[model samples]
Target: MMAEKEVQLPILRSVYQDLTRSEQRIADYITSHADEIMDKTIPELARNTKSAEITISRFCKKLGFSGLQGLKIALAAELSSSGDDRFQDIHRGDSYEQVAGKIFGNIAEGMQDTLKILDYAAVERAINALVQARRVAVYGFGNSATVCRDIETRFLRFGMVVQAYDDISQQLTSASLLTAEDVVIAVSHSGSTMNLLKTVEVAKKSGAKIIVITSYAQSNLAKIGDIVLTGMGREVHYRSESVASRLIHMAITDVLYTGIAMQQPEQYQENIGKMRSVISATRE
Candidate 1:
């Protein structure tokens, strides 16, 4: 059986435009010579790229690796594969079909990679918290707020008490009202949104358990989460938020929703039926 391939290089290229000049230099050098980089030490790489060792280490972390060694290992694994031509970025001069293919391909690959790194134990813990909580509050800002709303709608179908707050002040107020019996699901792609972080801080103080859905595990928000679920994706340039990341977040939400429904099939089925009946009555 063939080993699964890592998506490091493709992820690097996807976020290349967002990297600082020094980080870009290191990324370019490593990408262009994956095999060579695997053999070189961090100091060697920094010297070769004319960048500082600390800069190289930061670059590695930015790509979701723990450090230089982790980056090299992932690079070696990826290089050993047939290579990832599917994740190539969409270019300006591409035809409609080409653009569609690239976008679809990137999303597919991202979902696959996300599955590889998913911490099922953490997911189960999060589901348990949601199942037992008296109330659930979803907090997010910007594009992440949309994800929070989507989660709210899905959970509501199961007859769960859920609230989604997009406004900063409202989120703070809602979080402050949460108690030990409540749960907070905070979504942030960057995991460093100050407003969202502030709300989470308040929620934590109120003794509400926090479940974070974010891209980086090492982020401050993730540190505060009682249970952290990561949504990994290649962020493309020119977009304010990661399209692929949103899909992963939704996928995780679907898993939690389905798992909860399965825990009590009869009651969940009844809830769905009643919800559908109410909607149908409104239409008539």
Candidate 2:
């Protein structure tokens, strides 16, 4: 199936944090005057946003468009659509059903928005690296640690020599042992965790390949990564949790796990059979 096209306004909103100041100005202009943006030329848009023409072009490309024309087409389509199902807040005093609906809706939207920006080429590269590596180490911190643990659990069933590190000290120690034959999957949502970066740097010096899963592809973590997978989402009010970044990271890692399985179907089947046999014996 063909990939779904990203909606202009929602993409602009989702990736706002990663944009430069000039790009933010352009985004603000487009979002506020979306209906009128189609009528204006690129030069006119640059003038209106107090940015250069090239800046407008970069802004358009940053939003996954070819250029101004592509952005305009998406904007026009959004304008023509009947409803605005953009990000919404979960209000207080709502009934149980209302809250549940908003949470589920936001999670689904987060995944779809993430799909819009996912780099398929990078994903393939990551799978190849994992499949060939002599060892794999997954690292993350705080809320991200849960994702790391989940990856550890899933990849083990495939019989890959992988470990998850949530503690910075343990991560640094592990990094020191990685070799060029290994791969490191680092999860940092903001991509600005100093300790995580330090650990990754150590791994890089040891010559391990880096695969970064983060919200901002422009983040320092992404900069040094061999392959970068970005996840996008805006924070909702009330819970204010990053529904997008958290879930999307898990989703991408799951995709990697599945890809590795597909690459070694016979091995995967054998490993799964052995694992199931042991687990089944423990059941009543």
Best by lDDT: 2
Per-residue lDDT for 246-269 in model 2, tens only? 787999999999999999999999
Q: In candidate 1, what residue range of length 10 has the lowest lDDT sum?
A: 1-10
Candidate 1's C-alpha runs over 4 A off are 1-33, 37-77, 80-84, 238-241
TM-score of each: 0.78, 0.89
Clashes (backbone N, CA, C under 3 Å), per candidate, total 0, 0
Scored against the true structure, residue 261 in model 1 reaches a CA lDDT of 88
Q: Which runs of model 2 end up more than 4 angstroms from their true locations?
A: 1-14, 61-66, 73-84
Provide C-alpha RMSD values for all models, in order: 5.0, 4.6
Report lDDT (Cα) of residue 168, candidate 1.
Answer: 94
Backbone clash tally (model 1): 0
The stretch of ten residues in a row with the least summed lDDT in candidate 2 is: 1-10
